[model samples]
Target: MTASRFPRWVYTEGGEPDPRFTLANERTFLAWIRTALALIAGGVALEALSLPIQPGLRLVASILLLVLGLVSPLLAWFGWAASERALRCGRPLPSSRLGLLLAVGVAAVGVLVLVGVLVGPVGR
Candidate 1:
């Protein structure tokens, strides 16, 4: 009997890798998902709470966090699939293309928060 996997494209081409490696890849994917959830939570918090921040800046920072949150899951899935494919093919793992972008986005959010805090709420 032939076993069927959900993602045929990923499973069809490459050989099965060690189960441990596959589990590790799954863990990494979950970690990325967790990070994405944190970012999304932060965005919601910024808007939902009555924090003393410049209104416009807070909105911008919240939006930025949301965008990063949206992208992270996609990167996580791509990374997971790529790593799985490499492991099965005996090829070197691929480097993350969006990891740097995520870092920069988080940093940008930090800067926005700092500026908003320093400036205080305007027109409030």
Candidate 2:
């Protein structure tokens, strides 16, 4: 009996890639997931903790972090699939499109936190 892989779409088309490369791709996916979890934790912490920052800015930063967290898993899945497909098809690995966006978002969150800290709690 043939054991079927879960993602038939990814498994069906291309030749099998080296196990090492596939393992590496899986590791990358896990790393992205870890990052997503960290983002989510940060978002939760911002709201749950009573830090002395502007509430509005803190909420915005938290929302942005949560959004990034939500999107990271999609990036991880699509990135792993695309890379695995390319490896199987002997094509060059595709460059990440959303990575830059995520980086910018994280930077924006940092800036917002900085501004909130600097501005302090207003009208509290």
Please report, in order, the local distance difference test score of every candidate based on alpha carbons. 0.90, 0.91
Error of 2 at 79 (Å): 0.7
Candidate 1 residue lDDT tens string, 17-108: 89999999999999999999999999999988999999999999999999999999998998998988899899999998668998899999
TM-score against truth, every candidate? 0.94, 0.94
Off by over 4 Å in 1: 1-3
Error of 1 at 119 (Å): 0.6
lDDT at position 90, candidate 1: 92
Instruction: After superposing candidate 2 on the true structure, give the runs of residues whose Cα lies further than 4 Å from its correct spot.
Output: 1-3
Q: lDDT per residue, candidate 2, 1-124, as tens digits?
A: 1128858777876788899999998998999999999999999999889999999999999999999999999988999999988998889999975689789999999999999999999976
